[model samples]
Target: METAARTDEEWQEILRSVRRVHFVGIGGSGMSPLAEILHSRGYRLTGSDVNPSDNVDRMTGLGIPVSMRQAADNVGDAELVVYTSAVNPQNPELEEARRRGIPLIERGKLLGLISRHYSNAVGVAGTHGKTTTTSMISQILLEAGQDPTIFIGGRLPLINANGRAGSSDTFICEACEFQDHYLSMTPAVSVILNVDADHLDYFGTLENVVASFHAFAGLASRAVIVNHDDANARRAAEGIPPERLIWYGTGAGLVWSARGCRLEDGSCGAYDLYHNGEFFTSVKLGVPGAHNISNSMAAAAAAHLCGADARQIADGLRDFRGAGRRFEFLGTFGGVTVADDYAHHPTEITATLAAAKGMG
Candidate 1:
């Protein structure tokens, strides 16, 4: 059987083939979003994970059955099975699916398949800031009233979850690079936020990581949006033609650049946005950090490429309050504002700390 469906009708037929879907490791962040999306799409979803998690409870509340332990019995009546990358072949549910000859789909491949159903699929990818940038893009699209279906790596306040099912044909998602999973996606527009020396455990080297990113960009059917300041990101997008490539940065010779960027209210940033050496708009970020400004630029560029106007871009960035755990402010007490962030990389930490230090 052909795994990929080239047309929406073909994709619909593929989905119609499976009535009951089973997911292994359904409690995971990556798996949970897909489960939610599939469930919302009218699939009879059943899942099993190693242990119970908040995600399991969430899925259960959604009326999807969730088993606490993974077992072959959990695949009961499932016509199709989906598994995360972390799942091993020895997993009883997976083994059962194979034994029963049920069609199996991996998480990334499933995302790709779902993307094909949409007329416009925007994939945000990078070594870091994938979550933040994806959230930003989602916000811009939402603010523009585009009604984009979004699958973000982080929980966005606007959606109150990691995924939002929209009626429009536009779909936005974070394209993860770990294990080269992003290469599976079929995006109309792809954004490469930045490429750095990370995820070495999987790719083994920066060169391999760049190659993977290049392949990701090559998958874009419409346009590839890349960061002009990041050499690695620029290099990876070299295969795309100049017309197909849209560059955004804070340096000379770029398509989009920020001018007069400065910290505002001790945390946020105020900047003048430029597109192709012409003043586009003045953007004042709701979230802090120059890094966020860059993220907003990328989001703006993507939304613009997809037809969002300047006002929508400005309003979107202004409305965005930042994703969960990324510079998330807990509360303020005794003249001290408590905040939490999930920055792991050194550059991420630096940006987060810099924003925190400037907070009033």
Candidate 2:
């Protein structure tokens, strides 16, 4: 598959035009990354969050001005404003941005625009496994010496480092389907790790979850990988052209399959992988779980499709420790490892428990 470049002249103009920007609700998971990206790109960034968090602390430390309150005064000197969906239109800063006629874009659109700038951008989308899958892909990219910019909804452990300055065109990020932001990404190679019923607050129903993924998969100009093991995922890929869809699962029609896997006896467990009906390699994942095994396959399929070598892919997968708040071992307090995961949804809870049981 050919690499995707931003063809939209308007998007290019936005990136070019953003010099100093103000963020409303800047401490959020989504907003922090946008702030980081813009700041890294030399944008004079100012932001306000209702409360202070580590993310906000990090931004201010980077020299971006931050306000503790969402005052309209925060937007006074800004030429542009960025807001997350969580930022209500009633937000004083947001309203001020509107009154000043400054450009206001959603956090999702900014992230999408950031993704388009990378040549090997892989957007991992699913109702679950997004952070884990993204971390899996990032580990692979890093182990192989591929300097890819990385971002996940949860912080990853292997990267020990949160994000990096990539030397290559590759950038990997989790494309959350909530509020239909996953559709904003221009993915050259995308991975739909799984499709489950989630985000009922926005998507409303299981059918809507599948529908959003369908719309997202349709946005893929190159390859869209799906999980053959997931029925919803299979349905999601139904409309995608056969050539554009890559499936991964147990001995199946998918491009890649785990075939059979047993956790290796080590600090980070391992698995044997298969690609295109052939034994590919013994992939020692830096993370654990049957779900992660599947994520590894998806990452490999996307990386392979995007021109990364098998050896590099294997290294990246091996180096990925785990994502932040994702089964993270918060030091054994009393001979018991308390694993913390940011999983709140039903499916996520099940997977987290399963991963913990597997470790035990």
Candidate 3:
């Protein structure tokens, strides 16, 4: 997707000129948060979703008019039309907006515009763990009294919502790499968890995926935090200078490293965190899985760079139960335990099952 090429002043002017914004496919996870952010910013918002969802109900409860059906008339008096990638090309409401000459922007582009309003826009990008890691960072910042603006892909239990309009200059969100969507935002801190060969339908090859991540990292104006243990993440950070690059993993000589790692009950992990080879703090994760140890380290690195102390990081990680669907415990039936997780990729599935096996 091609984003609008405009300066910060130009985007600000565009936002000022518009009052009423309409969203297509508003119930989507990505679309709902953007709508909520705009609504909180005092923009008159309306939306249409093909199916009723919890998100639709939430938007209606906020007094935003949402139509259950899509029609040309649904674009009534909208000054700007925002559509997600999932919207059909021939949708009536979109066609009506185009016919009426209303300015249109993709959801990612609008997010980019919103990101510019923050001094510290931390974008978490990776093939997996984006939601979980983003939630962890949000928890840390919020617990530290930073009051950061958050836009996670899943529901964060700390705020009891997927997005929050905060009073601080920090904006944290998931920077998705599909179709180069992440290139739209300018992040002060870019956290690349790990790169993997997914999204082949859009990227066509693993090398292309790595290249896209490299470009995304270059967009970070201040710092780039990456996983040193992942080979692909290392490749993505190859050209970055030492001063601007921050490495986190389980090894010596790293800016942020974990040591004395031990797992409890084969799921949860406790580790001693180190910064510049000095003991920073001891962290005990409330969330299950050894993979989450790595996720917590990445989150801790981001929170520390953003002005959080070691105590705040440890407390935040200890308080986080988990994201909405990343290894959620459903219930036990007939002496058999059941749980749910959103692990689709092979790598994610492997990690999730390993944690489950440990619990058993």
What TM-score does candidate 3 reach?
Answer: 0.96
On TM-score, the leading prediction is 3
lDDT of candidate 2 over 124-239, digit per residue (tens) = 89887788777777776666656777777876565444554465777788899888887778887778888887878888899989988888888877788888889998888887
Q: Give a tens-digit lDDT track for model 3, residues 1-360.
A: 122655657656878899999999888889888998899889999999989987788899889999999999999999888998888878998889878888778898889888988889999999889999999999999988888888988888777778878888899899999888898888999999999999999999999999999999999999999999899999999899889999999989999999988788537989999999999999999888889999999999999988999999999999998888888777899997777798999999999998888787
lDDT of 3 at 268: 90
Q: Write the per-residue lDDT of candidate 1 for residues 84-193, one digit (tens) a residue.
A: 77788788888888788777777887887888878899999998788988898888888777887888877788877777778888888999998888887889999999
Higher-TM-score candidate of 2 and 3 = 3
User: Which model, 1 or 2, shows the larger TM-score?
Assistant: 1
Clashing pairs in 3: none
Whole-model lDDT per candidate: 0.85, 0.76, 0.90
Best-fitting candidate, measured by lDDT? 3
In model 3, the runs with Cα more than 4 Å from the true position are 1-12
| TM-score-based ranking | 3, 1, 2
